[model samples]
Target: MRGDAETTRATGSPPALRRGACPTLAAPMQTGDGLLARLRPASGFFTAAAFLDLLDAAEAFGSGRLDITARGNLQIRGLRAESVAPLSAAVARAGIVPCEGIAVEVPPLAGLDPSEWADPRPLARKLAERIADSGLDLAPKLAVIVDGGGRLHLDGVAADIKLVAGAADPRPVWHLLVAGRPTGVSGSVDAMIEAAMSVVADIAAYGSAARARDLPAEPLPPGSSSLALREAAMSPVGRFDLGASVVLGVAPAFGQMAAHIVRPLILAAVAEGVSAVRLAPGRAILLVGPAGWNTSVLVSLAASLGFVVHAGDPALRIDACAGQAGCASGRIDTHAVASHLIAHAPALMDGSLDLHVSGCAKGCARPRVADLTLVAMSCDGRPGLSIVLGGRAGDSPVATKRLEDGPSAITALGQRVAETVEKGESAAACLQRLGPARIAAAFSAARFNGIDHAGL
Candidate 1:
């Protein structure tokens, strides 16, 4: 929900989709192609058959375009006004009930990962129910995260209220975090729940527009452990050995998957004895295989089917929207440029920073500013790709290139960075050192090599 605002700004959404509104099924948002709907299955993980039914619903009603968002929600695009209700019905018929009320998020592999300190599902369920029944008119976008420490903690995910597990003394100690920052508050499970609800109640008094950042600091509870931030050691795009079984984490190229593409992948998982398909945060799909099933074949096949199977894959660092190829507002092919960067930009993809490729000014792919952002734009009637260094999609560009020349321009930028980067210095650091003027000069260096501007 923190990131959904950019999606609605792309163009005129449906009547129900007000500016900065989430495209929930009840209120499908209008987009360039048609209505767009975001869905999260109540039963987090979906059985192979159930997922196939969902895929059928997406293809039949929408334009076959679906995306596993950064927060792990499935959003279907190109839905028609008439097909919206049918799509909802089809989902219900498939037994895939959408999660309603305020979004109380937890890691996708909550119960499955044995490495987790404790499963957060029960507490999350309780918290969600408490908020719903409390008659508190909280903001529609309010989110609560119960982070039971695990291999896949909710590190980068944002929330109005976040409860991260601290020391597991008998029962786990929950460190209360408000808006991604710790609140100098840690307490017993029951105590933390009440604290979260109390905060929710406080926010409710402020009305629907209130975010966690809007409130002032709260007084700490007695014996509050200093709030700590825990990040995931491993990337979500890899194999997770769950002792009893294994879960293969695969990601669609650029987080967006065409239904035609996902169908075959789902069928392949079923063939490989994958019982359930769970959507993981960071735009990943978790294929939970049955115990002792041969998964080597599936892993290889998935790689061939345009899925990033390895943990260190560079494609994971890049976020791109459906550019000209899929969206009507696109000025260039964002995917093409991102694909080029993954294969070509070794200096840029050293895990130094994230690369955001936006189709237009509205950078729906990422809510925050990236280390480097490549935005597609147009000057007069000429299509161009703008390179924004350390800024959001809407930020002004340092350099511009012809739409067709975007891939090569990015390649040139990478080559430029590679040549000048100091030893042990990250691409981000080097860019920061060089400043925007130098970076822009490098990005446009290739195009002006021998061109005669005076002749034109």
Candidate 2:
């Protein structure tokens, strides 16, 4: 676990994965379920055959389990030190060139979307090239999200630097943001790239682990505006007619799918003559087809194959880490808990808030704060669930329940929220109105006169 530069020099063989470092084919991370490596295609997509071949490599060298990270990166879990080189060889043999250096991200529909003010891909490419050649040795996790006023833009995504293009009156206007704060620096694409690199160089001065958020506050004038942000679940997950082309977006349940489970998807894509497959944020897969091609057939197939084809799917709102089944650090079955909540807590999961079920305090699945967080732990040597209201996975819990008692407790809490919600009020609002004490009371199975649990 000590793969930092200092540690790697003392002990050879790269020691272990450095803390806060991004995993790569050359340097993988040690996790509870063995070594984990990540791969992001340089072209931001994969050929159907290449993707399938990569999956075969995953099954051969590691667990067949694959995760499409929330940020749209592919992760191969259950790797070993001995297998890393072979996995790299297999990936290279598959013609997969992994993206390297500072991440310059753009919308999945980059040049294809009619709604975009302009294509950010070219700008992103230029910025990426400059960053790569600068030899800055920036933080591995640094990201630059470029939004071109598209239907599926990355406004809400966290980034060290952000660039957003406005509609073209004559030419598109671009805005630059550094570390979530705007710099009055706005103009052409070249201007934004320079502004971003300047900020990146400043961050580099702080050392390898230093992020933009760690920079000292500097008051600056705000830019023209920001895009109206939408919830991550509202990410485009259905068919889209991009004027010149068509695309079908789909995701496996909870962003985790068996490598082989994609055989049918690949077969359908091939039949549809799909040109490319892109990884999308919100754990979506975008299948691009020829213009005017009928996407409904492929959409139907994806849904039938148990993929989340639309924004409204319940699986999109839940984030669960690999629990006892996959990871050694897990204390309980997180996926099972998610399934239980989905079956029993429909009234509370009204698409108003995110629910996180973490196997341990690390909160690796969804690092951000969620409306409701359940951290699985051991209570006096017995598996237990710790409820954290309006907090993160690692936060101190206000209520606790035995894992055996989780289903009943969750059902009771849902019933309470259902009864407490007023007409036109969201579950989130109701939870806030009820307060943490009342929410904890419901988890403790104290009464709210209950709502209809007739079906549950």
Candidate 3:
């Protein structure tokens, strides 16, 4: 399997995880890749040295593949059962500690953003610590997001409890929300944490299975006022000015960074006088450096190291899972097919459309809706793809077609789709015009033709 390092070589396979449990550095879960260990960096930031140490540890103890998960957590794949203990120990020695209890996420530039209403890091840390000490039986995957009303927002990401900084009304306060719904408001951070703890306590008293959303409706706290809720925009990729300094956000293709490139990238950032490296939402690595540093040179170096330096890069629109190469459940080469699609239909990455090439229905790459989703499947013992339109990977397929002899077939199909869009038809409009039946027929026919074929 992918994450099971030497364990797969020695024992053939590692033990599977208990249902509903997420893999951690201390207790990894067995996957098709072996054992997968997920490490949540303390404070969501890593120094250049610490980042290099993590990369080294991953390459040494696990498979050389490192992934930044959608939630900004780091994952090391291809580990053996025996390697888990050593990897965990090495990570500790490297000063990388996983966040325990319910996951509490804040904005990547929480404390640094000048336009933010408040610095959310201290409040987030307090909540995490309190939740851990509360001894309340919380679900492992349950999470909270503390939005400081900053430029880099966490609104798009869902959380069990959301604490958004209230707009300035001559006094600082926070709006306490349960599952994104307004519950109450607090004048101070301590009051906000207290209100959240009360809700958690209620859930604990009810049952372990109860979530924040399951709690009965309650009145807002006395003297609390309601304010219009607005989600801030996220722009973590590319160059952005922070005060007098410049911060560059770099993302690896498909959020997967090979071990070899990690050290070089971090070293290059450090060479540019980067003081801090933060993991942002959307799998972006934020490098904070002085304004005098040569951002263009750093961008070039990062691009050379296989990192996406530009927000408009074509790779940004493609989300692919580790296919047959790394995932056992995968039936097709997701990355290969995605590359072909992007090469043939460059406009698919024009920022208007989103494409998710999932290795399987599990949709590990992207679980949410996309403009186009290609789910890998097997048809009559031959690799094929089930195309899902206007939905997610696990959603029912709109059309299905078997892969032809070579990449030409896939390219031809992609070209045809691109042609349809080129003729002033939006992707959604084209899908609506063709419908599922015709879409499938077009792909099936294109598979028999070559790259020159068009007219889907």
Candidate 4:
């Protein structure tokens, strides 16, 4: 399947979705079961009825399971082949417009962040709508960012045009980021969008056929030009001040939530006057509107709804792909084991930790480093689990080491991690203070049989 084929549909005509070899549809794709509807969420804002329409569509066309891609878009799978037209209409009725141009991403709280000099969502809408409305005759690999004042940064994600908002000016100055690097400054959103549109024209005329990363190729395409750069005035606000990781880190049991549960969650958040509700990459909902609301009540509502509340709970950092029944590639029910480990979270977290539960070895949920990783495999006619730990992310990152395999007990595994961390050490001490050698041994013994799993 060619990547261009998949991307073409995103820029294809409405009503009739183009055919592509890519398994994931940029436009709608019909199979015997249903149409896989790929939605484009530019600013991540949807009406309440529109939100419920998604619930209805999932129930009507798909398998009642919605997949949130890493790019912050929603994918509906398992739809009846005949339901394509109605499904598309339903999505349109739900207020999600199919974007036909470059994808743009920004901080979830771009508009409402109090610390930001300007709201980026309204302007982001202008940029996207302009590109679509202008009927630009060129395909450009362009992306833009509007950084809000909050600490929820957008770094790991790639972008072509990034507009950071917190500059020294009284009004937010828009700095045009080209190829993930700053290119120029503009006081007006219109001017910023115009500059990016020019970059798109350059791509169309010059033959910068590859993504921004592939710029090293010689004999560069037809049109290529250097862009002027600009600097943003730094503010006094701390960079990581985006509060907790609670935005998208919270997950529901089985990664499932009913309309009753979901609506109330949105209402609770809306009552606090949140600006928008974004489907997070972590397969969770991020309610962004205003700050300083009743944290306890929100936590209570989410907990009551059967979501594993991560509010202030540093231990619940593990994640998994849809394993077993949910995915054809999965070999085990990773969600079940992850749930079991989470229940005994107090015994699992050694200082701060992150884990990933991959069904087979595909590891779709996360590709980056984690403190612990549990990869599933079958061995010796029995289901076995592989354990890896001591991985890190960001600068000087490392992947977890595979320490054990064979039917390891999840609870025992949790206890082993906890016991290793609480070695009469201060909370501020680094995770390695527990001694990597000791943690490795505990994992080894537990995989074979050190701790009991009577109830499990």
Candidate 5:
């Protein structure tokens, strides 16, 4: 019996959600408003017109709010019951192709980077289309990534299949995983997709609790599940800075963008020759500007985007999922609470504190490791969050553990974590120097009643 199954049985719950229609796209029309249609961008590239369409759709059909998912996809809020059909048509007309390769993510600057091994964009598109048209039902959330000789790869970020470049092989090799653990390797993209689809369907059929991490650690069933892999063509592009968002950054507040203030600032940057804009995870946008935009102007742009850009802005590390409005499972509007904390509690937070608040235990909004995490769990008529601290992200990622039990306790603990990080130094310096044990100690100190420091 797999651990997932054992856990599900213990809880007397249905199998972990795998193949049901996504809430964002579960309507007859299958669009963004109902929370079922997640429009995944190939390599995070979208046309300006498409971007505008998304903005308009978000404002009109859905809640006038936007979310940049941890998977690097754009999300629209405030969807009604019957908006899926029109939303899907509008998306298709805007030239945003919904292909099977929707999960094939590339580095933010694949073409722009000079020293990459191979540009993985074209190959990604080819594989994505084949999977879309293959007629095999797959988990709509199934995803993969191709590392084109870049320094970055999805080390800990969850994915069903990942195709990484080999040192000597002309054809890129595929590395398959069950959860986040490696399961097997293959040379064929088509075969990899087949294996991936098999895993998806098997889980769906048996009501099994298998994920990419739960596949049997034996050789994959061999058959016609392979395809010839090839390298993507390279282009000698000129030096241009394709602006990318700072990794592991969260919004100053609970992912809110005051419309009237931020829209003109974004448009002005476009006027000043920004090629395109990206809605970054953790609720920020990356403006890929021309080579010569003024540095002061860029900073001003970020400031206008609702960020407090300064030397020691402690609010940069906090993030929250759309708690009440966007998700039905949410018990509290954590975004509202997060906003209050970010504004009034800067003295309670220091630069080193990376806080994530999820409305439910699914932990969707904050995927990457953080210094402190506040996940919502229900208790009686009231709702609260679990506070965990001392996580980090790198080649090897470490997730934090719970330190406090409810929202009030978590907020109280966060102030201490912030103060400890600000122990007579700058935010950057404190973050670089602080270790997990010390941060954990701060959280433990805030534990109410008779909780011992067993884990710490």
Candidate 6:
């Protein structure tokens, strides 16, 4: 299939199997809002001019809302059937090409980081070319990561195959990891690629539903070695000193921003000497520039434009879907409720708290398990929010409450939670202290009597 042809539906209608396929620029998936198309930059980086042009195309052809996905791809939401072709063409004209074949991801600072164990770009390029020409049928979501062992590592991101740089015990080596588990080590890029290709080909032959972890364990590739690799500790957020220059990581609230906010932010970054904007894992935009660039000013500007500059920001603790405003399947205003909960009780952001406010059971925003998950559901034929503890969105709820009572009730619950934690207790310790029975009783009491209390 041609690269541009993948951007739209041939019949200009919604795809029949929306959930089964990956939504690319050529074939957008039908969502509650409208058609949603995702674009992956060829080089994992975008220029300010190219980004602004793409933003303009989104505003002109689709809804004026853009989302930066967890994998660092750009998604244009709310597109009409007819708009896909034009949007795809405009994007191509702006030099933005969607990635093809099994996606191979690298860190945002792939080649520029001088302190890296090895530059993974050359190997990444060779792997991409091989995958494109291999003709091996692979699953759409099958992916690989090439981590060069820089401060910004890809250890946290999930991938089918991982090629991570190993420590130089005399010489630098690359460890071939499958499903986050290291299998063997290679001293050269070619050897690593050969091993990875063999594994990918084996996976392709195992049928579409098969994954790397599903395959049986096998012996390491010939002429390869084994080494114990340790995951590097790093934060993709915050400022990083890149030798003589600096890079600032800026995150948008919920990894999304209005199209209007995007343009001004890009223009401001360009004006402030930002040459290229790279999207990093964890949904951060890295602004690269000279050594003495005014990062504080740029950070202030980004904050004013509704961007999250601090890693400790309360908004980072809450993961919410588009909710009623953007998704038709949403039963409640998840963002509103999340904001209210954060503002009413600030203790939720104290430490390592995983809070997810999903619009529906589909859980597009966060599919992973969280400490506190609120899933939209129907109660007594009325829209409600199901409270799930230490589970995912699709998990059975421990309790349910009316959506109308969500704001005040959740606020009260947050207060109770805060008070429980204020007694010099950890979040986990507080949860253990306030058992499920007592917590459910408080939620029920808050919903029934509409009273605010700090006791559970």
List TM-score per model, in order: 0.92, 0.91, 0.87, 0.67, 0.63, 0.91
Q: What's the CA RMSD for each of the models?
A: 4.9, 4.2, 4.7, 8.1, 10.6, 3.5
Report backbone clashes per prediction: 2, 0, 19, 14, 20, 4
- Residue 5 lDDT (model 3): 38
Residue pairs of candidate 2 with colliding backbone atoms: none
Q: State the TM-score for model 6.
A: 0.91
Considering only N, C-alpha and C atoms within 3 Å, which residue pairs clash in candidate 1? 13-30, 14-30
List the candidate numbers ranked by TM-score, top first: 1, 2, 6, 3, 4, 5
Residue-level lDDT tens digits of model 6 in 1-456:
563464235566544433455787767888888888888887888877888888899999888787777777788998998888888789888887778666789988887777778888888889989988998777788879988867787877889998888777765688888876667656678888998898899898898766898888767767666655555546566888888668888888887777899788788888888888888877778888777776888888888998889877777677787877788887777777677767875655565578888888988878778888878888778777777888889899877877766665676666777777756776666766797776666565565445432111
Query: How does model 4 fare in lDDT?
Result: 0.54
lDDT of each: 0.81, 0.81, 0.75, 0.54, 0.51, 0.78
Q: Which is the winner by TM-score between candidate 2 and candidate 4?
A: 2
Compute the lDDT of residue 105 as modeled in candidate 2.
88
Per-residue lDDT of model 3, residues 38-98, tens digit only: 8778767887677888888888888888888787788899888767767766777877767
Tens digit of lDDT per residue, candidate 4, span 89-191?
6777777765556556666545545555666677777776766676654333355566543434455456755666546445656665556654434556777
**For model 2, how does the per-residue alpha-carbon lDDT over 1-456 read when each residue is reduced to its tens digit?**
223333444543334556677888767898899888889988878888888888899999998888888899999999877777778779989888888767788888888898788998888889889888898868889888887867788877889888888755788978887788876667888777888788888998999877898888677666555544443423768878887888888998878878888777877787888867888888888888888888777878888888888788787889988877778898877877888788888987888988999989989889889999988866568777888987889898888876666667788889998998999999999998999988888887733234432211
The residue-level lDDT of candidate 2 at 193 comes to 80
TM-score of 5: 0.63
Error of 4 at 356 (Å): 1.1
lDDT of 5 by residue, 254-284 (tens): 4454334445655665666665655443344
Top model by TM-score, which number? 1
